[model samples]
Target: MSSPWFGSQRSQSMTEFALVAPILLLMLFGIIDFGRLLYIYGTLVEAANEGARVSIKASSPLPSNSDVENAAKNGAQSLYLANPCPNGPLPPTSGAGAQNPPGDQGWIFITEPNPPTTVETSPTYDAPGGQSPASATGSCSAINPFQSGTYPLQVTVRYNYLFFTPLLEQLAPSIILQAYATDYTEY
Candidate 1:
């Protein structure tokens, strides 16, 4: 003459936990992995911004793209708990004759608007009100304003992120992170 459900209640609870434990563990790991990914993205963005700021300030008398890239790398290293490249700086140049002075290469192209030029061969057709022949219908010329003017700086950082956690690595391949920043020269 005992209670009908008393003896079975504990077994029911145990069975429930056994059924749900794996799902709960999976969800926890998934959350951790997502958080790690977000952290990596934030680090990359900050690094790019720092590099762009350094480049725009003209920290180097003649700042090159390589200089900007290095700045970004330094920023990333500062943020990363475990750096991907442990040895030294990566080579900035593209191919043969790539290695030179630290800042020999990696110059970024700066384009400028060209000046206007008068067309010589066009006929001077008068407007309805006869408005000085429309300034001779000049054509625009191409000019390199950056030759003497301060130009905007852009920095790009490319990183291959390898996952060390076996759980995440098996699920997802290596990640690629690209960061970029652009700003006008300080001066």
Candidate 2:
């Protein structure tokens, strides 16, 4: 024979679980959304790097704009889903917005003359504790002229990531994930 307190223990446990379930579910959704965000960001970064790599290859003829764009598309082929965010904002073409210009893949931007200054970049071009790489006087010369030394090439990929959770959408909407890769020609 159990006391009244023990008799109601199962109900108490049920009540506690009912109170905590929503919060726990919310946390679980948040973790999943965070993981998705990271995956998208990593994909964008690799796509941009692939575009830059295509542009800077030591091959005789330089890669055309379309070629680089194709490389980027191939790099991010996993994200070729049917509109991840149909209701969300579209990527901006210029200005303080997304800065994603029109490309074969729609979100890749290429700059062959100088590295982009809009986003934070790692100092991969410079030696440890050494001076940053500077643009030379004839850096932007035509390929026919074939200027000496290394020339900078930058590729950028912008993606509008929509949260899978409805709570996240109400709180912050979509996040614009931008990635940039800069490389120099092997001369």
Candidate 3:
């Protein structure tokens, strides 16, 4: 005399769980990945700013491309600059402290824009433009920074980030993060 609904509740509940579990897991992972992305981006931007700040100084010993590059890399090194892919070593940092990358350094670049030309050469003597010498390119270098006049110094950084969530892999291999900063030289 048992009804057809003797134990249907248990089976129905299991089916519902099976369907909802994946969705919930995906949502959790997405949130984690997005937060990681923002943190990494902020770090990169700060690094670039630090590099530009150092390069804009017009001192006896000017900064070089490598010097700027080092600054940028060092600033962001405390974080996972590259993909920590599964099985990777310990994270760049465990807590809220800074540490160097467990693996190789991420790709960093610093460019030097051509400074303004004070002298003009042509069939006749003429000024290139009314722009002052300080009107140099925004790029900066330890070798030569903006001198004597107020000019803009720019720093750029790029990073390849790996997602810990496998779901990201299906969408794309790796995400690209970039940072740039521009500061005026001390006149």
Using TM-score as the measure, the top candidate is: 2
Judged by lDDT, which candidate is best? 2
Across 44-101, the per-residue lDDT of candidate 3 in tens digits comes to: 9888788777656665555545556667667786854432211111122224432333
Q: RMSD to the native, candidate 1?
A: 16.2
Per-residue lDDT for 102-154 in model 1, tens only? 21112111111111122223322111111122222223112111222355544
- The best-first sequence of candidates by lDDT reads 2, 3, 1
Estimate, for each residue in 1-187, the C-alpha lDDT of model 2 and write its tens digit.
6686566677889999999999999999999999988988888888888977876776645465566777888888776422221111333534665433222223665554443333323222321011123332221211221233576766767776778889988897767677878887664
Off by over 4 Å in 1: 1-7, 59-70, 77-148, 163-167
Q: Which of candidates 1 and 2 is the stronger one according to TM-score?
A: 2
Each candidate: RMSD? 16.2, 10.0, 12.7
Q: Which ten residues in a row have the lowest lDDT in candidate 3?
A: 122-131
Model 3 whole-model lDDT (C-alpha atoms): 0.53
